[model samples]
Target: MENFTEVLSKINTAKVIAPQIDYSDYVALDLSIDNEELAQSNLQNAKEYELYIQRFLDRNKAKIAFGGYLETRNLYQRSTVFKNLNSEERNIHIGLDLWINQTASIHAALDGTIHSFQNNTALGDYGPTIILAHHLEGFTFYSLYGHLSVDSITNKNVGDVIKQGQQIGNLGLPPINGDYAPHLHFQIILNIESNFGDYPGVCNAGKLDFYSNNCPNPNILLKIDNNT
Candidate 1:
């Protein structure tokens, strides 16, 4: 069996995040819905996460920001079982959420063509999303960016090549951004069988193992934290 790590290691390091954005403009939000306080936590507490993102924007208005790792969540994974719990309940989060108050210019982390894009209009859905495909390190992978402004895909077509750090879209606001807060849902995918526009940002308890491996830590390629 081909190990996923082997594929990741083969990714073209030179092409990934070449025009890296400053971390000062972005903050980490919930990555998993593992904790009760945050998992079942209401949107009111979104400020905590939003604020973190805002601070990054406040410092670097012109630069892009990034964060939201496994440690970004209250729970260990993103599971519906957790979401079914009460506010004090612990849940898991699956995606890395990048925070920025207004619609910050979203860029492609690498050179890739648009695989799919859609407006996932749902209370907790991605609202607006885009997925790109790229071949790196002898392996092909996909990157999903969620909670984007509806206009982002106004005239974009599938297979369109987006260069690394190229402005692809901007962030959307609440009510349109899944009602959580203003932020972007960024995820690195290995084999995306189908789930277009939106994937399981949160997984069920039974499939934890599957998701953990299928969706390797995005920071591995993003290298968001150079200081650490």
Candidate 2:
């Protein structure tokens, strides 16, 4: 029997973002805690993030910036959901984030049925999110699309049959999209447990082992070169 990672490697998936943009146009973005540039610069708000992302894209000559699977970031410090006096700070991002200044079309990564959808309206939450259940090679897994536009989940229903590459929604703007710049937070989960439309996008250092195993790097399915 193969493990979840091995099983994921067997399938060829479609682009979760619009197909019009080629993978060659993608550039790796580092929001990790170690990024010196990000550390020196102050990126506290959505507008600031948008500006920072745009400058990076302009310099790299890329259409979209993607990365951040299992990367530790300091951007979540402003939200109480990520840290407080009581709970462990969850700064380690567990999903692949695709960033773009404009609102881009979001697509399904594979053929699957909608497991759940909800508008998580917390200060730094996934404003509108969708989760899909996929089955392959005797394994069942899930993909989450977060920071989506409100209309994305407006008419969507549970168990909605979604085809690979189908347009599910568009990237959302700030305040509505958890107060972040326009971006798609994509993650893969082996066991969703009792999670409905939302899942932990970040984890504390102590729980890193378990979360990493449950949520593998989304790049395994995206296959985009992690080149900056």
Candidate 3:
């Protein structure tokens, strides 16, 4: 059996957002615990966090801020959803986040069918989410789009076919999008197991190996060279 990375290389390079945005407009953002600016700021609320993101984009003269795959972030401390009673907190992000304006059109990375979707209503959750099942070279996998507006999943049914670059939905606002800054959390899952519309986008330190293997870096398909 081919490993996930090997199979991912065979898929076409994709752009999850609009094509008008130049690759030069994409800047790498760091929300990890080591980021001094994030540590000093008051980011407990979505609005404040949104402003922080705005400042970063403005300073860098970029339209989109990306990164966060497998990064350990301090932002998750605000939500208990990532914590276990006696276990290590899940601070490792497993998805690639693209920070952009609310209502920005989201695109499908490849041809797939709607596997599942739901509105996760928790304070810090996915809000409106969608999962698409895809196949390439006889191997099957799944793609997850989180932090989406309700309209994205509305009127859509399971098994709906989604073509590459198809408009899947729009980026959601705070409270509606798990109360965080507007962004799309895109993840690739090798085995969804029993997860439906939602899957663990963050993982505990000890389980990093497992999740990292199951969920490869989305950049493999996005092919985003943030340094540009």
Candidate 4:
């Protein structure tokens, strides 16, 4: 069995990013569904409106890159807009988002092998997604890159070695990247539990505790604060 403490301690050596578009950018806004009280309101349209703003941000990502660990939008359970969404889509965002325009180069966070890759096609899905497996300090973990362009997985194969900072893939565009906006839904998993090319990015309020513990913050790996 893998010890969680040792895995977390090794995080200090893991490659990290600022979680922003670039170094000089400041936080613009944050949106998250963690707010229990506000979630009760008929905020379905409000969430949609936020997507529109996110689309606008996608259009101008080159100029206004996202940074820091942000709670970037609100999602409600009553709204079918997000209700009908798959397990991977429901329960609002469960990871940090690195907002940027299309085709930004995605670098691997560590030396790992391609565990799996797929083009998850759906209105609001990961489009072209990739998962990398890493073994460190006697523990195994996976990293997921969603909203990637199709070209990213064109010649990729399982078990292929991906060095740290290698260009894993390019960001996908609207209609292909889950219909939300152009950004990277970067998440880390302690145990994939057999899911491939896709994992739960959102979880219900009833199950937040389990998901939160299983999916530790990517910021631990990104370590953005030290970079500045």
TM-score of each: 0.73, 0.97, 0.95, 0.75
| Candidate 2 vs. true structure, TM-score | 0.97
**Residue-wise C-alpha lDDT for candidate 4, range 54-169, written one tens digit per residue:** 55465555333343233434443444444664543355466667664435777788889999999888655678999999888777888898878889889989999998777788
**lDDT by residue (tens digit), candidate 3, 1-228:** 876798787667558876668888999999998899898994888888889999999999999999999999878777878875876799999999999864588889999999999999888889999999998877789999999999999999999999988998988898999999999999999999998899999998899999999999998888787436
* Clash numbers, per candidate: 22, 0, 1, 10
How much is 19 displaced in model 4, in angstroms? 11
Query: Which model scores highest in lDDT?
Result: 2
What is the alpha-carbon lDDT for the whole of candidate 2?
0.92
How well is each residue in 1-228 modelled by candidate 1, as lDDT tens digits? 556666654444321221354444344433434545444434344455566445545655634445544443542223233355553333334557665565467778788999999988756667788999988756778888888888988899998988877888888887777766576778888888976666766665466678778788777666555432
**Rank by TM-score (best first):** 2, 3, 4, 1
Question: Which regions of candidate 1 fall more than 4 Å away from where they truly are?
Answer: 1-21, 24-68, 71-90
Write down the lDDT that model 4 would get.
0.66
Q: What's the C-alpha lDDT at position 3 in model 1?
A: 66
List the lowest-lDDT window of 10 residues for candidate 1.
Answer: 10-19
How many angstroms is residue 143 displaced in model 2 relative to the true structure, after the best TM-score fit? 0.3
Residue 213's C-alpha lDDT in candidate 2? Answer: 94
Q: Which stretches of candidate 3 lie over 4 Å from their true place?
A: 84-87
